[model samples]
Target: MRRMDTKTTTEKTGETGDNAESPEGAGSAGADIAAKTTEPVEAAEAAPAVEPLDADALGPADEVDKDDDEDDDEALFPDEAPASASAGIGGAAAAVVSAALGVVALTGTWTGKVVAERETLIGQIKTSGSGTPAQQISEIYADAWHSVALVNGVLSLVALLVAVLVLALPGRPSWVRAVAVAGAVLGGLGLLLSVGTYFDLFLNLPTAGS
Candidate 1:
């Protein structure tokens, strides 16, 4: 019985030793597999990254995009050209009419002055004359001069109003604006002068008999 026990114990020890050696061999194999898997991953990570595309090098696509943008701008601006020209013409016409009316006002003012001066001179001559033909002629001319002054004053006032309306209008050109401003100034002055002359002529009219 003792000898059988010894042989069994030796056989068990030999089996345990083989089991330990098998575990070591398995561990070495597992480490080699892990190392191989990690090497490929590290190599991929270490490689240089791909460069992004440059905007300047987008050759045909960028040019096509720029051409489309230019076409859009042309569509927006150039198509409405005629309407802008028409507006400019209208603005110029209004300024011209206002300037012409200013000239008319200035002319009426000058005419009023001439009539007023003649009436005054005639009145003086009539006072100096006594039951003479010249006195009769002076009386008739004085009435005509007074009538002329009234008409001239009304005409000048109309011109002044027209000029003011033109100035109030929109989109005037540079030259047109200059002319309108000049018209306004001259028309205003002439309006005041003519109004005063008309009033004076009426007040200083010769008595009906003279």
Candidate 2:
């Protein structure tokens, strides 16, 4: 009977210890699970929110790129610069031409000499048949002189008009303007001389007796 009682006491002690250990293990597992679940939730709450990017915000790099594109476009076309250069060259040429025409008028031209000769021939033919000595001299020599004067006057007038036109144009170079002024002055002088010669104001016709 004593042996049986001892065995029964030992079995009861073991069952009581097991029940206490089970409750402790269960509490530790529940605590670990709760910590793991709350860790993810706290991290989500602590993280910063993301914002959308603004479309209209341009930085310095973007502006630089835009400027480079514009410069490339100007290089590709390149029309305006050449056109202006060509216009300047044309104006300079016209100024030179006006000056040359003025000089030609002041001097004598082959065309003027040819015209004078033709007029002289015509006058001689007309007066050779019937005319006094004074009439013949007036018709032949005076007519030829007037014809040359007329040709020179026309050339001078043309030069004067061209020079005036060049002066009236805007944005001419300084050298071009100076040359044009000279051409105008020479043309005016030539025209005056031509007029005087044509009207016989410079040298009158010889008398029939002389």
**Best candidate, lDDT:** 2
Error of 2 at 99 (Å): 0.7
Model 2, global lDDT: 0.88
**Candidate 1 structure quality by residue, lDDT tens digits, 1-210:** 999999999999999888778988789899999999999999999999999999778989989999999889988898566676887777677666766766776675566667667776666666665645456545655555655657665665665666666668776666877876776776677667666665664356455456
Q: Model 2: runs farther than 4 Å from truth? A: 1-81
| Local accuracy by lDDT, each model | 0.70, 0.88
lDDT digits (tens) for residues 67-129 of candidate 2: 999899889987757576887888788788888888999997998899889988888888888
Task: Give candidate 1's whole-model lDDT.
Answer: 0.70
- TM-scores of the candidates in the order shown: 0.43, 0.69
**Count: clashes, candidate 1:** 0
